[model samples]
Target: MNKISFMLNGEKVSLYVEPNDLLLDVLRDKLGDKSPKYGCGRGDCGTCTVLLNGKSVRSCLILAIEVDGQEIMTLEGLSKNGLTDLQKYFIKHSSFQCGFCAPGMIVTLDEFLKKNPKPDEEEVKEAISGNLCRCTGYVPIIRAVMDYVKNRGG
Candidate 1:
């Protein structure tokens, strides 16, 4: 096992991980955060998305040991005191149906909006292109993101 240290949900965390263990496994099996689902398990599906240093990444594509000293943010970290504005907007717009891809979509959208606060429709779609949702057909998701941006005066 390799000892890895990283920041999770704004708190410093350290744990032992097997060399072959994926970040998704460590986060869910070890850290007890199940939001990053084990979908596809091959990185094609973005259901396991997380933020590494404020950038969206597929946790299933990364080894637990590779994240040493990095700052990781899961869906749980996005809400400070309660539901974030984005989260509220998503719910208000019914962006999620089955909710399988909500966590990754939210994290990806959060990172995207941070960089491009006023993203065009295409830009918004491109930002979440990595994530695949079988529900809502993506229109509602895009609308929710646009609404959030508008509400924030971006």
Candidate 2:
């Protein structure tokens, strides 16, 4: 096992991992952070998405050791201080149905909104294009994001 250290949800963390271990497995299994779920083992499903250095990335496609010194943020980190306004908006709009994809959707859009504070409906759709939500039809999610942006003075 190779030793690695990195920041997770603003906390410093260190662990031993096999070189081939995927980041999603390390986070959910080793680190005990279950927000990054396993939808598809392949990178096609964004359910394993996480923020690496403030950018959205497919955790399943990344090796655990690749993030040794980088910063990683999961849904847990995003809402460490309680529900954020974006989460509230999601609730207000009932953005999710089965909720399997909620974590990835939220994490991806959280970073999207930070970079593009003001986004149109098309932009919101594009931002989440990589995330596949079989339920909710993407309409409620778009509405939630747009409403959140408006409420935040975006």
Candidate 3:
């Protein structure tokens, strides 16, 4: 095992991880942060997406050691100050159904909104295009994103 340190949800964390351990596994199994779920291990499902250095990335595709010096943000991090505006909008619009993809979707959306604070519907859709959601049917998700952008906050 190798010791690695990084900023996780604004907190500095150090842990021992195997070189071959995937970030998703480290977060979920080792750290007990269950926000980033295990879906398609190949990284195609996007259910394991998380913010790495303020950008969205597939945790499954990243080795735990790769985040040694980076900032990692999972969905749970978004609730530190209570529910954020984006999260409220998600709830207001019922953006999630089965909820399995909610964490990744929220993490991805958090990064996307930061990059494009005022994004159009198409842009919002494009931003979360990397994530896949099966239950809500894209309509509600799109509406929530667009509405959140329109409100600018709340």
Candidate 4:
């Protein structure tokens, strides 16, 4: 096992990981982070999305050892102080159906909005393009995000 050190959920963490262990496995199996689920396990599905250094990434595509000294932000970190206004909007609009993709959707938008708070509808759709939701359609999700952008901040 390889010893790796990184920040998780706003806290510093160090743990052992196999050489080929995926970040999703390390996060879920070892660190007890459940937001990044095991979807396609090939990075095609955004259900395992996480924020690495403020950028959204597929945790399943990352090696645990590669995160040494890096900062990893999951939904746990995002909700440390309770849900944000955008999260409320998501619930208000019922952006999730099975909720499998909700974590990634929220993580993606959290990062995207930080960069482009005033994104247009098309831009909003494009922002979450990588995250696919098999349950709820995109219209409600887009509306929720757009509402958050227009009223919350952007």
lDDT of 3 by residue, 47-79 (tens): 999889998999999999999999998988888
* Backbone clashes (count) for model 4: 1
Give me the runs in candidate 3 sitting further than 4 Å from their true place.
none
RMSD of each: 0.9, 0.6, 1.4, 0.8
Scored against the true structure, residue 2 in model 4 reaches a CA lDDT of 85
Candidate 1 has its poorest 10 consecutive residues by lDDT at: 76-85
Clashing pairs in 1: none
Q: Where is the poorest 10-residue window by lDDT in model 4?
A: 145-154
Number of the top TM-score candidate: 2
- Model 4's C-alpha root-mean-square deviation from the true structure amounts to 0.8
- Ranked candidates (lDDT, high to low): 2, 1, 4, 3
lDDT for predicted candidate 1 compared with the true structure: 0.92
Clashes of 3: 0
Which predicted model would earn the best lDDT?
A: 2
Q: Residue 47 error for model 4, in Å? A: 0.5
Candidate 2 off by > 4 Å: none
lDDT of 1 by residue, 48-77 (tens): 999999999999999999999999999999
Computed on alpha carbons, the lDDT of every model, listed in order, comes to 0.92, 0.94, 0.88, 0.91
The per-residue C-alpha lDDT of model 3 at residue 49 equals 91
- TM-score, per-candidate, Cα-based: 0.97, 0.98, 0.95, 0.97
